[model samples]
Target: MILLCPPGVYKAQSDTHLLAGRVAQLAHGRHVLDLGTGTGALALTGARAGAQSVTAVDLSRRCVATTRLNFLLHRRPVRVHRGDLYEPVRGRRFGLIVANPPYVPSETSVLPRHTRGRSWDAGPTGRAILDRICDGAPEHLEDDGTLLLVHSAVCGPERTLERLAAAGLSAEVVDRARIPFGPVMRSRAQLLERSGLIEPGEHLEELVVVEARRG
Candidate 1:
């Protein structure tokens, strides 16, 4: 689908497409929530796939506006909100929750405010956002619902599984894709190598989709 992404809104990328396939398969007949909605691509996919309802949340005002506009342009039904992870939807639950949150390890913990880096920078261990999702997603899922998260293996998918499991959900790697470094990873290759996050000169990183549900 063609989306209007403003200057600061994240453009849908590999992770988005990866999670989208799962959305198409699992979103029908469910009330779906797309966290870190970016261009609302995943939420739109859910709506298109016949979801009972679709709500999207993003931390960026630009992203919220872009997504809302995109949905309007497509004449699809969606509720778009601007807020941090799970904040806007407090006390709400859904049948499916999907996120492709920021997971690229960055040098600092302070997230970028004015750049596109906000879309992927997740601080030193890249768990800043991932951990939050792991902790909060389970609480927001219906008893039979599922949470789907896509991120780089560099961020430690095993840890995600452990966290989700500890939170009372059964979690596992559902999908993986090894793609050449994008501009962000390419720029941080040397740093990642020095930090032992990746093998020296490793040009490809594996992306993983983690699926979680009530244990």
Candidate 2:
């Protein structure tokens, strides 16, 4: 599929492909929602996987437009919305929801505004958007629905599992990959280590795909 990622919109990366692989497994004939659908990678993946319907949501106008364009370019039918997580899909429910949110830990508690950094910087604990997704997903999911989320271990995968469990969904880490630090992570290695989020001299980060299912 031809995808055009304009400036300020996130280009699909390893984490995106990881989540897309998982989405391909469960999207057949199911209604799928791709939260934080940067570049519409996962959404298109779901559509191609035979999903009954696919809806994508992103907060960035650029991302929303890019996703729509990609869907059109590929001739995939996806409903694209521009809003915060779960906000655009209010009163709706889906059988599967996938998210590759901004999980990189930042030094400040305030999330970035007016910068491309908004695509990767979560707050100080890196739970700003992660926590919101974990909390809000259950309500948007049908009984027996599944939520696929990919994030860095530095943001605490256990916390994600626990939060989803607390919200009445059974959660587990289904897949993980150790990847070398990228520019964003490489630059913040020291700060992450100082914050005890990562071990000193640890240059590798584990990206995990957490699967949460509603009973």
Candidate 3:
């Protein structure tokens, strides 16, 4: 089974990705949940950081298999589930919910060149997944639990903060970085045009890490 499994079926070792190594440092010693846990990057990092338990979920079966393999490889106690955001984790709450969902503004193509799945697409406005995650997060987090997300600056941290407020969460900035533009930006622009999210010709110049906590 191991030999026949596709490359996508096993979690990969990536060093330069945004969330891989940074998660442990940020999520230290928390009861964490990793939404969209592709390749188990954040999940593994949480385990390494001394989380009580790491519950990671992904919509892709392949991603679930890969995450399972990664957990075993590290001998960490992680629960890998296959389902969309919050579905697999219904009735459960965490002290820290971390997600690196596809944040490319809608109309742009996700990276990796070959990905053509929900894991890579963020809908027409690129806020589809992020919106849903934020809307549902309050119910899945403890009063002091935090929701950590990495997304594009194009998506407008201001808008994200509004969404969090609508859901009764207080939003804050934890980190920021500038990534070179990609096809995702084109998609984001197109989505903004169609959805009236922004005037035509506006540009997004950076990415941001947003942290929100339930009241």
Q: What tens digits encode model 2's per-residue C-alpha lDDT throughout 1-215?
A: 56898889888888998888899999999999999898999999999999999999998888989999999899989899999889988999999999999999998878876689999999888999999999998889988899999999999999999999999999999999999999999999888988999998998889999999985
Candidate 3: stretches off by over 4 Å:
1-22, 107-115, 183-205
TM-score, every prediction: 0.98, 0.98, 0.79
- lDDT (Cα, tens digit) per residue for candidate 3, span 1-215: 01223555323322115554456665776779999887787788788888887999987787888788778877788988988889998999998898888765544444332354455466555787888998999999987888888877656788889999999999987777765445545555666667776567766446677888876
Worst lDDT 10-window in candidate 2 = 106-115
The per-model lDDT (C-alpha) reads 0.93, 0.92, 0.73
RMSD of 2: 0.9
Which residue window of length 10 is worst by lDDT in model 1?
111-120
TM-score of 2: 0.98
